[model samples]
Target: MPRTALAPDLSPGEATAPRVQGWCPGALRPMMSGDGLVMRLRPRLARFTREQILGICDAAMRHAAGLIDLTSRANLQVRGVAQADWPALIDIFGGLGLLDEDTGLESRRNLLVAPDWVAGDDTERIATELLARLDELPDLPAKVGFAIDAGAAPRLLDDSADFRIERGAHGGLILRADGRVAGVPLAAGAEVDALIALVRWFADGGGKVSGRMARHPAPLPAWAMGDVAPGPSAGALRSGVHALGVVCALPFGQVRAEDLAQAVRSSGALALRATPWRRVLLEGAAPDAAPRLAPGWPDMDVADLAGWRVEACAGAPFCSQASVETRPLAYRLLELAQQGRLGAQRGAAPAGADTRTVHVSGCAKGCAHPAAAAVCLTGRAGAFDLAFDARPGEPPQTADLGMDAVLARLGVN
Candidate 1:
């Protein structure tokens, strides 16, 4: 796809307005947190070329905190940027062809693509078409998003989105509203039109609710549910992959810029695709080449269950809204979970058991994993609030327990 021409009016001042809460930050309109500006970059297709990756890392090191966050949405965020450096950073992104020509177009381009999509595949075609027509989309809420899961097996069911386009049982494309089980089938090459119609319908009050399509109770248009197979199991890909290139995870979805840069350089991979599950699909690396590219960056082959189970947000000093530091505690919690120490006693089983998912949020917002987890630890005034099989804001089993007390209670030494 050719790059859209840069809009003359584009400037740092024209970035999305700041919100105290509930909204995501973008490159143009970054959110101010305790640890400097939180600037998010939404790649066109959840992809980054090796050069692009190195450029981003360099930018982060010079203009931001040198930390690159692979968001659950499969986007990359350059966190901890200074106010004065925002313009320079934006210019750097523009030079890298990362920024959209129009600010509104950029914010509305909330898309998640299956990382395994190959060239000229259904996923790549449909995603590229939808992005080209972003101007036609209705004025939906900032967070209302779309997903293109055209892989033989769906891969983004866990990822949040207002609408989803996936392959139906018959191998035809289906445009499904987020909450609805059924979807209207699209004729060959009609995916973009149907998707636009659905968005327009929603904007015209077809769905009265403002957030995700699932949250709205409005009935879906006449469409039949196809016998679509369930999505593939969620986790890092098996080490010896057959079709797609090697897939691996960055521990806790955190990676140092230099480490990532070195990995990309050593792997000899042309590009990297970020997945919603916090794993990165190296485009051309073979099974043996993956580890050499990013050594010490935990791979699924070692402690697969523990690496995929735990998630934590940038809390405390990094985020102004957080009451305590979360990542460190999350690491400790994951270590205990892996050892089965923080198990049934904490109202949850071990990592590989039924309770395989864990979320440690610095605050009630649950920025890391918005969905309910098998075990949830939310910070409250430097103490932790415990919730089981529930999202934040729901009633908790205990509140305001210090880290040590909570650990002891969970039987973690």
Candidate 2:
């Protein structure tokens, strides 16, 4: 179904603005630490060598917050930082060539390389050079983004990237945006500059496109979705149970700092990738690897077994606009689900086929998803919308139910 912004109590005109920035009257709450200037430490990296990612996880747990967010783009952010420590963190990342603050171009610093590009001969070098140049570009668009992918093997190539740099007919990197190839030709070094220019140009002409890398149904592009991705910018193909597993979030994407820190400390010799999917990818635990440090691994497939889907913004306790605690509702749903009130997979459902996803919103501002879900629960007007996502432009299937009644619909009451 296509996305249409909705705010329960709004007048018709207010429907167009996003619930977060657009409708939430006080969305710009300060996220400052003691020193105050906001925690704005931007890092740069063409690729994460096995060693680098592990070291980063270690440092993140030690210096900043233990939580890492894998953005829709193949990038990571460590939150819970103290403002006074910003400069030092910047220096640490800068020394590793991981942090950059070239304001004019740095804000637009995200780029995803195909995972195959990870093992390719020239891919890493190309990625490194391209990134360095991105930081040096004349201008940066707060909205522009890019990707580099090629003959795909995994589900990741389908990831939506504004500028997808692919192999041109001449063996050069081609720049694509909003799904269309740029009209201009670019040499390898000029690729980064051209990308920056295109993003700035597009941002100037269009409405805000998030730095996220997924496709939104709102806008349509002239170009065909192509086959090529900057490697699986975030996941992998290592063989072993521990080699690859997702860090499952408890329903509405919240994990206690203590639990997260313990996991970080206990990891024996693995690298973690924070995923927008509300989990972490633990690498290096394959068969030939060292033993895991934790008592048990997180059953990454539990949600599928439980046959329930749920997502939410860091509302209430975290965000000021939240009138209700979305995570709590999400967990309650999970509990009812485990008892068989809701459906669970009879056997493991093949990946990507999980039919149910429960989205709980603090207010009407649905920050977690661009469109309505199979079930949309909001705190604002005190209602829940049972949707089918089966139709094109229908306001989600109308079911005005209370929290418990909504739970029972999924057989979870």
Candidate 3:
């Protein structure tokens, strides 16, 4: 569901904008945060060549805070970018073929592809066709997007998208809506046409007012509803060797520029593919490359980890809207894992029971993890409000406590 901005707190006759933002950041149009700027890059097919990867790392080190964030949409964000250096950084990106010069086309080409797609597969072909026909799309809302999950089974079921191209129970193609269970069946190669038609239907039906396809209340057209169900989920992809490459986890979906460059060099991978799950697939990388990345970086092959399930935003001084620091608390939670408080908690009992998924949002905006988590700590007036199995903006079970008080509530000394 699309989240509305929290109501602003204002005095009589005084005015202020709501703390939440509606548009997403892009490389051409970045967002201003407590940090300098957040410039997001949506890589083509969520894959980056070696040259592009090295160039991005170099540019990040030169023009930003040297930190790159992997987002839930399988995009990359360069943080702490100075306003003065924006144009220079963009120039560098253009040289690397990372920039989409047309702003309208870039915004309209919001696509999420299955990372495991092989060349000439349905995933790549449909995504390529849609990219070429982006100009044909109507002026839809910015937050709306499409997912091409035409692999053996849909792997992006949990990721956000307005429309989806997935496999049906009989291994045929289907164009599914975000909220609907069934979808329109498609001929083997007619996915792009069907997707375009569905998009047009959404736009003609006042979908812009809803801001996202899932939230659009209009019923689907008669032709758009095929009674067949989608194929079973392919499950979450973890860090390990696969037929195409080696997957590695990025703790908190963040990586230092230096470490990323080092991994690229050490692994000698031909390319890197980002995923919504905070894991990167190093294409053509040797299986042993995972261990060579770093000690702190776990590949999930031999390491029992919980950091992959924790989400934290840039807190306090880094974000103007945040009242308290968040990452430190997230790290503290990981440290507690050493004490056997939550050892090897991944894939165990559900979230609230064993505290598997944790989100430490700097403020109620919950920029890091918008959905509900097992444990949530939301910042408010320099204190923290704790919630159990809730989103950051939801009412908390405990409120108005300092950091130490929060620690005590979690049973920590």
Candidate 4:
């Protein structure tokens, strides 16, 4: 389901406007928090040097919200920060030499850094260059995405990006366009710029997209190819990721400054990696990690781990524009999925304890996912639209099921 802007644009804004409207409801530019820019971080890169980890924690506490939100994309977002600290943090990022300044190219560059003892130098520089080029992109074709997967840990594999590059390319770096991950040789040092140009060209031609596609999204680029885009991910979510040692949903996808400090202070764990799955991947832990889980700490298993699986946009709390809580709805749908009625009735689930992927959105933004899911619950004023993929080429079979009714229908009291 597609998410609609809070109050229809009455007259929409520019290329980057949707991000503001989509991620944030009312801000024109990124609002500066007290110390850092309130943004999300990707966590696939988990091994932060002890010094780097400590410095990040200190900066996050002093400048930003002191809270970190790990995302499924392996990105990290420090919230509650004031605007003043942004430049300094940006500088700090520069000091760490991890800051890539590509105006308005933030979301466009989901560069995957390898999660090994030593960061891949080429991947790092390439990611920086990609960020610069992505920034130069006036407005990427909505459908285009660019990723430099240095085959990072868990390897940011098969994401919904318009283009992906990795070390194993037939060429120095292969470019996967139009959905396939086949390496298309770039004119050495030309991959990043070529992609920026490609997306710009597509945007000029009218391609509106947020992530990658499983196949060509129609019209031009007949030769492009990419793997099947993954569903809303829960793997990198801090509040939602699988416990490095335990299972728990991170509260609000954030950790208290004190908690973070404690995690950092603990022996052995020397680094932090933020993942799009919304979880913090603590690196350099003691030989035994079982002793590290704080008592009474939230259990990762309690959550509808798949909450991230349903790609719903920020619906209520953060997005005042949203009419409801999309994550919660997605959670409910996942639980209802346990009922296994849809697949069971349709012969889709396994014998028992099956997991059926579902996407629930507060509105239509559908930030969590752009591709279709087995089920989608879109919230509307006074009710919800319960729908499912009846089949491709066929209209979606939908009903006027509101939240309560939908819940009841799902067999959840």
What are the per-residue Cα lDDT tens digits for candidate 2 across 155-248? 2345555566555444445555554433333565665566555555444544354433234333323333333322223343332343243233
Residue-level error in angstroms, candidate 2, position 163: 1.1
Per-model TM values vs. the true structure: 0.76, 0.55, 0.80, 0.51
Please report how far candidate 2 places residue 34 from its true position, in Å.
Answer: 19
Give the best candidate by TM-score.
3
lDDT of 2 at 144: 46
lDDT of 3 by residue, 211-284 (tens): 89888999899989887788999966777888888888776777778788888888888898989887889898
| TM-score, predicted candidate 4 vs. hidden true structure | 0.51
- The per-prediction CA RMSD against the true structure, in angstroms, equals 6.1, 10.3, 7.0, 9.9
Candidate 3 pairs with clashing backbones: none
Worst 10 residues of 1 by lDDT: 1-10
Better structure of 1 and 4 per lDDT = 1
Off by over 4 Å in 2: 1-43, 46-68, 77-98, 115-122, 135-140, 150-156, 167-174, 181-255, 274-279, 286-298, 301-309, 315-325, 331-357, 362-374, 378-406, 409-411
Q: Write the per-residue lDDT of candidate 4 for residues 46-82, one digit (tens) a residue.
A: 4445566566667777776565554544455655545
Where does candidate 2 have its weakest 10-residue lDDT segment? 21-30
Q: What is each predicted model's overall lDDT from 0 to 1?
A: 0.72, 0.45, 0.78, 0.47
On the 0 to 100 scale, the lDDT of residue 116 in model 4 is: 33
Clashes of 1: 0
Which regions of candidate 3 deviate over 4 angstroms? 1-18, 291-309, 314-329, 335-409
